[model samples]
Target: MKVTDIVDKLGLTVFSGHEGLGREVTGGYTSDLLSDVMGHAAAGSVWVTIQTHRNVTAIASLKDISAVIITCGEQPGEDTMAQSNEEGVPFLGTTLSTYELTGRLYSLIS
Candidate 1:
């Protein structure tokens, strides 16, 4: 599913990198641990995490994720947001828990 499609389907908030919502994503991974995310998230997947640190962007960049969706109503750190914008990475946020967001995203993709 396209990133924008998932956003619309799940009513997700595009906090930053709105332009990237048009991109396509084949899968989604939900995790708060940066190292776990780095190991698990696939290249073309959206990474759903509650972590607001710059390491999230680091993981996104290193993992080649389609986007980083911050769950649990959290926002990325200022530096992370700036890095995401600079790197042209899509960064979204939601009030839902990681489990809730993952289920919704999976439903949309399925």
Candidate 2:
């Protein structure tokens, strides 16, 4: 599924990086640790996390992720949004907890 498809399916909010809406989502990865995500997350995966720092966008770009989803209604940092837009990685938002969002995404993509 594409980022746009996942957003529609999960009722996620698109906060930035509109250019990457067509990016394909191969799977989902849920984590708050930057190192864990950097070492484990696969390219084309939608990353679910509570982290909203600018480093999140850096890691997303480095890993070639499809999108970043901020869970539990946490707002992303200004630099994070700017970097996301610059990198063309969609920055999404959700009110659901990390577990709930991961479960929903797993069912949709698996």
Candidate 3:
């Protein structure tokens, strides 16, 4: 599935990096721990996290993540948004909790 498809399917908000909406989403990783994500998230995966810090973007980019979904009605930090755009990694938002988001995403992508 494409990032855009997930956004449309889940009613997610696109906070930044619209350019990456076309990117393919092969899988997903749900975590707030930077090191865990950095070490485990696969390339082209959509990362489901509550973290909004700029470092999330750096890790997402370094790990070749397809997108970052900020859950629980949270918003990304300004620097995070900027870095997301710069790295062409879509920064998405949602009001649902991580579990809800992950369940929905899994049903769609799995």
Candidate 4:
């Protein structure tokens, strides 16, 4: 499914990177550790985390992540949003906890 599909299905807030909303989502990865995501997340996966730093966008771009979902109602910083837009990696938001969002995404994409 595309990033836009997930956004619609999960009711996610599009924080930035509108250009990437058409990107495909092959799977989902839930992690807060930067190294863990860098080492483990697959390309085309929607990453679920509470992290909102600019590094999150960098890692998302490096890993070719389809999108970043900031969980627990957290918001990405202004710089992070700008970098995400620049990277064309969709930065999303959710009011749900990480676990809940991950589970929902898994069910949708699995």
Query: How many steric overlaps are in each model, in order?
Result: 0, 0, 0, 0
Off by over 4 Å in 2: none
Q: Sort the candidates on TM-score, descending order.
A: 4, 3, 2, 1
Off by over 4 Å in 4: none
lDDT per residue as tens, model 1, 1-110: 78888788787888776667778898888877777877777898999888877777777878888898888898887898888887777899889989888988888876
**Model 3 has how many clashing residue pairs?**
0
- Candidate 2's TM-score: 0.98
Q: Candidate 1, 49: how far from true, in Å?
A: 0.7
Against the reference, the lDDT scores of all candidates come to 0.83, 0.93, 0.94, 0.94
TM-score of each: 0.92, 0.98, 0.98, 0.98
| lDDT (Cα, tens digit) per residue for candidate 2, span 1-110 | 79999999999999999999999899889999999999999999999999998999999999999999999999898888898889998999999999999999999999
Task: Give candidate 4's whole-model lDDT.
Answer: 0.94
Q: Point out the higher-scoring one by TM-score: 1 or 3.
A: 3
For candidate 1, the 10 contiguous residues with the lowest summed lDDT are 14-23
Q: Candidate 4: which pairs clash? A: none
